[model samples]
Target: MSADQWIAFAAAIVGGALRVGTPFLFVSLGECLTEKSGRINLGLEGVLVLSAMAAFGGAYWSGSAWVGVLAGALAGALLAALHGVLCSLPRVNDVATGIALMLLGTGLAFYLGKPLIQPQAPQLPSIALADWSSNAAVRAALQVNVLVPIGLMLALALWWGFARTRAGLLVRLAGDSADATRALGYSVAGIRIAATTAGGAIAGLGGASLTLFYPGSWNEGISSGQGLIAVALVIFARWSPLRCMGAALLFGGAGAVGPALQSIGIAWGYHLFNTVPYVLTLLILVLTCRPGKVAVGSPGELSSTRS
Candidate 1:
């Protein structure tokens, strides 16, 4: 490729990192938060799909993109809360309950989103960062969605909150030792429920990004398992909110490889390149899941820690 082509390709990857990474950032952070409280919500895939549909449908009906985002958050929060409540019951398995919720959320989304598949909804606005560039491709590649900044702020806020806030201490205490937290007069179930719901709402924002920003549509295949991959991302980040952002960008860049290469007239291996993110996920899991290797900074009471 020529210098100009290379520049365009580089710009595409950078922009893709910002664009594709937004949802990953949100979902990973959400998972990080939940894991911090010693709970897991494996059903974020369902949350992603359902929230995407809800966001799109809400935007279509309300004529406001923000409203769509709200709908997505609410949908995710409701599903997550249900998961939390179910898990609170005696002898309930968090993983099993999450799987059931995933199926339920996905089925409900498909059924309700049928009409949304054919219509256009209001889309989130973008910031044109490459407007000064004469190259059209560069300009196009640099148009970033507004959600990126919000996600970044959220990551920073969460990291700070975890380190400095009393509420954060409470969550850490609950996750580290439920018996101790209970002895201290805190309700372990309540804390976990709140954390899970909040995480769901955050992940729901990721769903909004999928439908209201990039790809800009609601469909059955819109999520493509980004939600599930985010669980692995949280593990990779060792449940650190800030690290989650960095890891998300890495995955986002991997995901962008295919499209970036295609922009430079290289399409022969497009499908193979598109698999980079998934491949990376597998590699990360393999590397991280070693015998006797405890994740640095992992919550003590996390189920994985016990396992």
Candidate 2:
């Protein structure tokens, strides 16, 4: 890349981070919440796909983008709740339930969203500060949706909620030691169910962002496992919500690689760019997410091992 080309590449990466990170922000925040309560939902990918379809269908049916977003959130919450209920059953594996939900979510989205594929839905409004400016590059620099900031704020709020509030203490206590929680007269299953529901609603809204606002379309192939990668992001952020936002934007920027490269006419390398987030996810998981370190941040009841 030439000097100007490098500048453009850097610019593209910034824009890509803004546009692409929305989904990551939501999903990561959702996963962070679930993890805080000592539960994990692998079904987030499914929730993403389902939310995309629902958002599209809703916008098409309701004639309002905001309504579609709410519909999508509901879909995601319902799925997440189902997973929560299933996991609440004796001997049910959360990981397995998540995988099943993923398949179920994807399948339902494809089937029900068939009608939405053809409609030309109005693009939802975005907060474009630079777009109003006379300068083009400056405008281009800030094409990201307003939700990006909201996602960041949510992380900060969650971090505070987890570390400094009564509800946060309950969640932490439940996640850290279910036996102790039960002894204290709290229902572990109930808290996990609530956590899963909240996580699902938020993650679903993230999926809605993909179809209703950013690219602003309803399509089956919209999500690219931003949801799954979010699960890994939780580990990378070590369960800190603020760190999850930072990690999400990083992944979002990585996700912009293919398009960012192509924007400057470097099409040949575009294929390699698409793998950036997953590769980063793997690297972060390995380098930053030491299993031993996770214990401090993790809920007492959650365990990939030692359960």
Candidate 3:
């Protein structure tokens, strides 16, 4: 490849990062929020798939993309709320419940999304960020998803809220020491439910991005395990919203590598390239998880991290 081709490849990866990373950003932030309230909702995979189907169906029926977004968020919230409620029961295991929810969510989506596979729906609009570039490839690569900025702003807001607000403190307190929160007369169950629901809503938006924006369509395989990978992403980010954003972009770029290479006529090992993100996820888990040592900045009440 010449210099120009290399440049295009780099641009494609950057664009893919922005395009692909949006979902990761939303889902990881949602998980971070849920963990902050002393609950971990691993069912986000289900939340993500179910919401994507709901979003696509809503857009196809309503002829409006934003309506689809709303439908997705609502679906995610409702599903996540169920997980919260189930986990709140005596002697229920959060991890097992989450796995069950993931299965249920995916099954529901596949069943309900049958009619949606063939229809075209309104798609989310993009903001042209490379209008100045005469190169069409550059222009196409720089077309930013409208949801990217919104995700960025949400990350910033979450960071601020966690660091400097009463609500944030309460959430942290709940995650760190439920007994402490209860001693202060707060309802730990209630807080966890609310946080999980809110997190699901945000994750629903990530689903919306998948169907209504890049690779914009509804399919049983649309999610491709991104929701599951987000669990590791949160751990990699140390549960910080801002760091989640960066980690998401990095994963997004990793995801883009195969496509970007193919775009530049490098098709060999494409399948291997697509595995980068998953490999990265495994590496992060290995590096972060140690024998009997809690991860730094991990929520105290998060069960998976506790020794």
Q: Each model's TM-score, in the order given?
A: 0.98, 0.92, 0.98
Per-model tally of clashing residue pairs? 0, 5, 0
Tens digit of per-residue lDDT, candidate 3, span 205-282: 999999999799999899999999999999999999999999999999999999899888999999999999999999
**Cα lDDT tens digits for candidate 1, 20-45:** 88899999988888889888889999
Candidate 2 lDDT, tens digit per residue, 81-137? 999999989888888888999999999999988888888664566776555556465
TM-score of decoy 1:
0.98
- For model 2, the superposed segments whose C-alpha errors exceed 4 Å read 1-7, 131-138, 288-296, 304-307
Every model's Cα RMSD, please?
A: 1.2, 2.2, 1.4
Global local distance difference test of model 3: 0.93
Which parts of model 1 are misplaced by more than 4 Å? 303-307
Q: Which stretches of candidate 3 lie over 4 Å from their true place?
A: 303-307
TM-score of 2: 0.92
Q: What are the Cα lDDT values of the candidates?
A: 0.91, 0.83, 0.93
